[model samples]
Target: MNESAPQADMAEQLAASSFNTASRAIVIGGSMAGLLAAKVLSGHYEEVVIIERDEFQERPANRPGVPQDHHPHRLQDLGKGILEALFPGWREDLLAQGAYEREGKEMHLISPLAALQFPYEKDEGCSRPLLEWVIRRRVAAEPRIQVLQGHVAVSLLTKKAGSKLAVSGVEVRKQRSGGSRDLEAALVVDASGRYTRLPEWLEELGFGKPVAEILHTRLAYSTRYYRIPDSLKDRYSTVLIEGDPSLAEGSGVFSPIEGGVAETTIYGAGGHYPPVDPERYERAAAKLIHPMLAEIIAQLEPVGNPRGFRVSECRLNQYGEMPEWPSGLLAIGDSVCNFDPIYGQGISVAAAEAMEMGKALRKAAKENGPIREHELQRRFGRIILPAWWTIVVADLRWPGVTYEGSLSGRGIRFCQEYLDIVRRQALQGGDMELFGLLMGVQGLDAPPSSLFGEEAVRMVVSRSKQDAWLEKQLEAGETLGDFLERSFPVFHPASHSEANR
Candidate 1:
């Protein structure tokens, strides 16, 4: 059973019942971030217009505008909560539209130390198209908001306000009509993604370009769709093999999607590429840390040819650092900070930023004052700092990812060593809490600070010793039990205190 977007004019209802201090707002992207932003802006502005370049279909499908739509996407529990907050009942609405539910101990995670099955936690996974389609439809239901498709934004119309420049409107050219128009707006938001033309738009208006930090990992991935085999249909919903660069050069993922189809993605970084050819793509899964994915996919029938995608780098634009950053102009989503995509943090981070924007707008809503442009952009910029730091820290471990002066030498070493321990400890038995915390942080549910608690620090310190001993055993061709016996001969599994550090 699929849930449909509400046809009721809730936007009209809000316009009639409440007073609005702002006249119009324009969101420059129809992406997940833009849709969520419009949902928030609708409450404060009398009319919110979302400009998009693609003509959307009535059904769920991919568009040429979003190049990464072919990949498997997820709304981890943390992001799901944010979506539910913005659009009450979003989970239910999404589930009704053929999205699969992921819960319990359904993941088969492989690492360098040992094969691990994650403790059960609820989540949702779907194709990127379906997620975008549902969100777009919901954005259309608001009478105060309008989705303008087949129009490309050409330039930002700016005005010199005394000593400062402010964004006044946007100049857009219609793709269908070949006509151009100016859309005047008090607030202009750019969520146009990684390929955004904000750099050109800003420079033409005589503003300094924001500094950006980019790390090139050279990650390439090939994804193919499949029909789930009846044998594994009822057993588990996902199997992910985390790429262990030490043992293997690539990773593999097999998860259920809508329409009873499964999507398998094989990826590699550091100049490695998974095959896009059907025969070789199937063979690509065999190089994972485990052969479970290869065996599973062998029994299923693939629905389409494997398609290849690349994420050459992770970029974070420094907009707030500019003293002369224009007022009435702000950007969110990938346009501000785009991750490597393997972490699956992009969608969740966008949702979190939308919430921040809403929080900033509430001040204007209360005072009946015009929306504060510079303050809102700066606030949103500060809000994403924590996640931005977390992303930089993680990608530093990969080869060819240049972050030379950004992170201190000593700090980088400590994070690398600590994360190595976290991965090793996650593979050990009776350490579900340690693994869960790591997953939560990766899922954007828990803050990176959560991993630095007294208990966690103690655990890492203790595991550091264990990891050193385990390394020796591997060099000497000894087993995990051998290392345990040689190191902790007096203690067994019952000695939880030793493992707890």
Candidate 2:
């Protein structure tokens, strides 16, 4: 009799545990950010729901949610690593789906300062849609997550928590019928990207608009798909010809995608625009410092007419600085900070944000007992700020982009001098490691500190033999700042009034 009673007690305990494991979480948007967020949420929430506006296709293809999918997007080493961590073998899945290596094509980098071949990481190079779809399948397979497509999140449902408001659920509307419904959850995340309506939602909740720092990229990009020539495949090459700021052209990229197809995107800043017409695009590529892209275009057959995307500015929303920051809702990815698309930082940054959120939640659950919304907000804000700083610093170099000047003039000169040294070193001696390190920093695989290390400094100092031309500028009574301003005039901030005029 005592044995039977003990067995019954164990059964009751099991039932209780099962009941407690059903908590819910909701993530808005089903893009990379949202998928990554849902993957993280699955660890903490018993069930996670993803709300996506676009319908998913069986194979990877461009969707409406991501307007720039038509253009080439590479998963940086950091982003690829993060995806691998989230989905143990996502890289393999992508490769199996025709994702090729960065080395699939011969590559060349033509900079104003030097001409070199950029070394892309081995496990990278996939179309934007293919990468997203691969991750989507993994997220969908998670036992605790559910994908709901063709529904858009209209507003966040919040409840009064003491003097502050907390998000409790989301109100989503069907894309076709406009039918609406509310789904409750313990937490809500916005990863809706550049087209997010989170700003309006916050205003409706009585929070004055958040402060914003805008960097006017004045950038327009056009891409056309191409079928690689069989002769070129044995030696298919990708070329990056950076725009000459003095000439008003921004940048041109010819990348080989997985399917023996290449994407040529000519981009520009200021008033110079990427050509949308095929013949004009050829003219634009011909004007680049290098003739590789133009030559390649001649050999390849065009897949479709070139498509163009223009982004007026890159905006950083200071949501954390809001007078009354609300709990229950937080944003990640392009929703919080949309970088200029040329950098290829969006996917990586989104992955980083999602991973950080997961770590914070798990840590809070173990050590802090329960998550404090304000503290969570503060921590999240801090986690993303460094990466944001890195991205903005690079973007600010363009005259059309804006920044508040945390990076000083002297610092700019130091960077200019350092880059000049590295480029010179790479060109003179073909110091692959030096170029690789700079590329790594750009890929978010390493911090800028990596470039200033003793080895790097020594290599540049030894190989560069000192830049005589730059030294001459300094010798001619030019300040460090003045030298940089004169040499790379693009970095100097533009006058809005003059720009307008």
Candidate 3:
């Protein structure tokens, strides 16, 4: 055989061998979701390639892909636990890098009527970039996982097998070289985040795109970083300075970050946008849902000019409604659902989804005959929907936010009743464990049902009359729903839709 003929035959044979290896998978996007997907796929697939359109950094730093990386991030205790389970000793790695293990920062859960500071039994958090970078490094160390940086996934390669659409592989293009290559794999995962083009691609292939449920609460965020003075590090702990939702203002959090620095992010809901200047940042902080944030910001040094970001509420991809989904393909993370970051639950939910994906993939592998791709997608959706409801519903209660769902009348009353309990409990300072538990559930450590349990509801009712602070606030004309409607009309559907709807 001539040199050219033999080489062509070898290439064809290799391509054939690549399909059934039972050890190869391709993942699109090298984000937190993508990296976590690779870690989960490491045990199941012998080799996993993560393709990214952005340049990959050896160290964890800010990049164009994740615009919100610079903002404050709180890895709820549940999220911390999930990461610990995923990468053993991950927390220790963070602690070693000057990431504070906050334990005694009393949580102040606020409502229009009252702000209750509870001595939390357990709570912790860290910077967003530091946490993402740490996890990315651990994932990259896996021998089976290889990150193909600066590459874009042009399209997914699928074939019709009998009556099923089987995902055979992916077509990718290298950014620097402008060269194209096709890689065959047993599975392909889409973790391309909120800007994912998967739905559009599916439409091009004749598959109907999944409908999106959007909660449009026109919100804007401005964030600035500060170096925490050594003396204030221990005394100055995490504080969730909030905006009075009833007042048409956004909420903010001032917390300790990874590099011995503090970060404050102020968000405005509806049309109450925070100006990208120091004076407006302070004014917004002072007038937030609670006024304590103003006191905290007054003591900090400005590390950088504030950066602004605007968001149009939350988005949930109803993948479960798809008529037909190809086997061996999965969507994860922000591509699956994106929640309002103000709730501080995004990281934890992502971790929870990753854990679920790992379990589903393992079960599929054990069955050996066929993969339950639809079931896997359903399982992922099940994990996301509850969190989505919590966030979208909360935003919808405000003046400026709008959504497709019915949130007026009885819905508004139900939310008001729930906040009534939240206000009372926050005033009495008697439900730290419960508050922590709710945070975990919101963070995806537990279910939403945990928040509305008989015990929690009873506690709210019992404390409603007894909370002096709440009673006083109510007497002073501060009701939860009224306060929210007045302060955050942007998140309130009726306020934005009355004229246009």
Looking at candidate 3, the ten consecutive residues that score lowest on lDDT are 492-501
Error of 1 at 203 (Å): 1.7
Give the Å shift of residue 104 in candidate 2: 7.4
Estimate, for each residue in 1-501, the C-alpha lDDT of model 2 and write its tens digit: 011123223223322333342277778888888988888898898877777788788788899889999887866667767777778988788778876666434567788767765454455456888888888888767888766767788888889988877788788777877667767777888889988898889999898777776666677889988888767764655678885564565688887777878888988765467788989888888888777788888988999888999888777777777777676777888898887778787777777777767766887789956555555555545544545555555555666665653345554555655766776676666877887777776776665445654455545666777646446536466655454444331311110111111
Query: Residue by residue across 1-501, what tens digits does model 1's lDDT show?
Result: 012222123222322434342378888988898898888888878888777888678898889888888888766555677777777776666689877777664677775677766544665667999888888777777888877677778899888778888897687777766667767777889989988999778877787687877767677879999887667675657888876653336878888878878889997776677899999887778867688889988888889899999888777777766656787888988988887777776777778777767766786678877566666566555555555656666666656555622444544555556777786666565467787788786676665555744455556657556646335334367654443334321312211111111
Which residue runs does candidate 1 get wrong by more than 4 Å? 1-22, 229-231, 246-248, 368-372, 453-459, 462-501
- Compared with the true structure, model 2 gives a TM-score of 0.82
| Clashes (N, CA, C under 3 Å) per candidate | 2, 0, 27
Q: Which residue pairs clash within candidate 2?
A: none
Model 2 gets an lDDT of 0.71
Candidate 3 TM-score to native = 0.83
C-alpha lDDT of all candidate models, in order: 0.71, 0.71, 0.69
Clashes of 3: 27
Model 1 lowest lDDT segment of ten:
492-501
How should the candidates be ordered by lDDT, best one leading?
Answer: 1, 2, 3
